[model samples]
Target: MSRKLAKEISWLLVTIALLTMFSPHTADALTITTTRKLVVLDPGHGGKDTGISSTTGILEKRIVLKLARMTSKLLSDQYRSLLTRTTDTDLSETDRATFANQNKADLFLSLHLHAGKNKGFFFYFDTPDNTPATNETTWKTQGLIHRDKNRQTAELFAKNSQTRNKKVKTHFAPAPVISLEGLQMTAILTEPFTITDIPGTAAEQDAFLAPYAKTLARCIETYFENKF
Candidate 1:
């Protein structure tokens, strides 16, 4: 080949290689950072386990399930987020934690209702020591609870209590076995309302619970934006 022709062919090959290297296909394969956050909502007690029952016949499981659905809707509308359990089916505690971890959740909230001869909202968390007995005692005594690392975050929600008769308490419990093995932020179990067997508290419980759900949703949103 002529020297001039050889030079032109070599330049053409170099241009083609450069074009292939910078093509959209290559760019599409590059990893990109994600800013989206995910939260897992676990509505506790379902199926055969109806949870606590109120004098008015409202089941604890039902109330929490409804509240969870509402919270999921609010999160989706406000933050375009995700949820762990979106229905009234049974989910093992361990399974719930696994789902949250697998999804790379930023937060894991287990929603439940308090039951007894009393009424109020309560939040639960695992103790630093991971001892079940010690954790139960701590909760019974303080009513406001969590691991040392999560105390500040727990107090933020506890202080926002709006019930006239209900007081917010923080207490520690053994870390849920499911959360022990995974990457997750604080796993909070909230008793936003109560389903008491006590008389005359039924209507009161219903009245307090509906608004409580709304407030809790706001608190969660604020917590993530400001703290986590």
Candidate 2:
């Protein structure tokens, strides 16, 4: 071939090679493989803080502890799980969140029995600033996504409660700091039932709460399954 023709052929080859090298098919794209997530359960109030008292002398702390244990057991048997406080021990709210974060828990559940004359289960989600521990940066960096997932899980719990005639009420903390440190963690404060100071509420409380442990377990399972 003539020199000019050879040069042109070489340039065409180089151009084609460069195009192939930078082609979309040859580019590296991000791949996200979501695995099943482990969750942490925080049973509120312990040893020293008896929490609210029922007319029958049943303590809120004790009820929650029992329920938490049951839920943890069920989760362990059925799915991935962890517990922040397994026994009758007092744990600060911040500590609980820290533990969950340290463990890289996909979800955080703070369990408690209600008092103050409430009748049914109440599910509380964190607001942006309910606790002193919450701040703008934390909320923006970590709180938003966590809070959204928590709300999603809580809503699922509410929907599942319909099977037992138990109703769930979802409340957002008025301020970010009202519950725990709102920014660093995504947490749910679940008051399954009230150990009231009133009569005839004991049986009602049990009826409401007995299925809660199982229901919560199911919710966690479902959440992680869908998440992964």
Candidate 3:
């Protein structure tokens, strides 16, 4: 009600307007529109912690990172795509989940590979913790609140992959103790992308991930269109 207070508030508003008009991050800020859902892709393992390997010396960490980037590129035009780790570096499971939550992600996905044969895609949805967190209000239980949506999203992708000639098996795989804990969005993790499935060679990775990501992008689009 005081004139001094009114003048200060008006000055603040004018300053904010000027900053909004001239800030370099204006475009970046605008990209965070509500109309487009945000998807966070997490490539599991990095640095010294190489997940798995094959006879050809293909590292699981390397391949999954590339796959995450490829998939993000495919999804970029339709939705906001981001990755937890952009390079070959070690990122903790907690940090990855925090990144997704901080970004207010609409969906979260983790990519990993295993040392095994090509047994289709191992898709995962979050499950309740074996020993559920005592504090229900904590972030650790966020996945439990969104568990149904997470499972449905996993199923949607799995069904779509089958149509694309990729065999996908859906399972309730993660607990709060694992990578997907405390995510406040629909989450899925694809596992054990074998060397046989996506070989060590760049040529093989590209060949496998291109079509794989294409189908994945389409599946994500479908999920957003129908569900969100």
Candidate 4:
């Protein structure tokens, strides 16, 4: 691995190591899987629906696209991945979920940047399903089953990222379950950082995003490592 990639993985492993030190039993219980996983990175609000803007005039749509690409690169070694949108084209929420479902992705990560005063990562898993299944079929129940895995994956991300961001004084909320329709596989929505909360010049803003991209990649690695 390149130095940059090593640093990213190191950032995550150090935290995982520390956590294991404190909770060896829990760590011991985790089942590591060697099977390759497929991750779908959904960059939110493309084209006309630019999500949020930065103080330095950066657009949220652009930021997320770059982040998704970076995260995908860091994760390429261990997992097969695809992006929901390659360019600035508007896609509906249902369409995004449908794409992941159609592709049979192992995990769906919907990327977004929140516009707020507080800084840090926030994650949400799919909430309980109220929508009835299309038919009494196995595929219809797939979404419901994936919902549980989504919550587990979200918590893994929260735990790992919270430890990594502690020194930076960043905060992470407890991953909440939220309603998202049309997903047939595990999914999580992530707001890694606030758009307006970024620091430094236009060029320096990328530095702010670098750690986040790596951190998210690490979280994905951690999830697959523990999830068989």
User: Which candidate should be chosen as best, given lDDT against the real structure?
Assistant: 3
Worst 10 residues of 3 by lDDT: 168-177
Evaluate all candidate structures by whole-model CA lDDT and list the values in order: 0.59, 0.63, 0.74, 0.73
State which candidate has the highest TM-score: 3
Could you estimate the TM-score for every candidate? 0.62, 0.65, 0.79, 0.70
Query: Which regions of candidate 2 are displaced past 4 Å?
Result: 1-36, 76-78, 116-136, 139-142, 166-179, 182-186, 197-209
Which of the two, 2 or 4, has more lDDT? 4
Q: Candidate 2 — which pairs collide?
A: 129-175, 129-176, 129-177, 130-175, 130-176, 130-177, 130-178, 131-176, 131-177, 131-178
- Rank order (by TM-score, best first): 3, 4, 2, 1
RMSD of 1: 11.0
Segments of candidate 1 deviating more than 4 angstroms: 1-34, 76-80, 116-121, 128-146, 163-183, 197-208
Candidate 4 per-residue C-alpha lDDT over 1-228 given as tens digits, one digit per residue, 9 for 90 to 100: 899999999999999889888996765555333245888999998989998887677788988998898899888476778999989999987788778888878888888888765555545442253443445534434455555566667677777877777643344333433323456776777787778866656567678778888899998888777873
lDDT string for model 2 (47-113, tens) is 7988778767877777777677778777744356778777888877667777877777777777776
- lDDT, residue 126, model 3: 46
Better of 3 and 4 by lDDT: 3
lDDT by residue for model 1 (87-145), tens: 66776766776787677766667777766334344344553555533434522222123
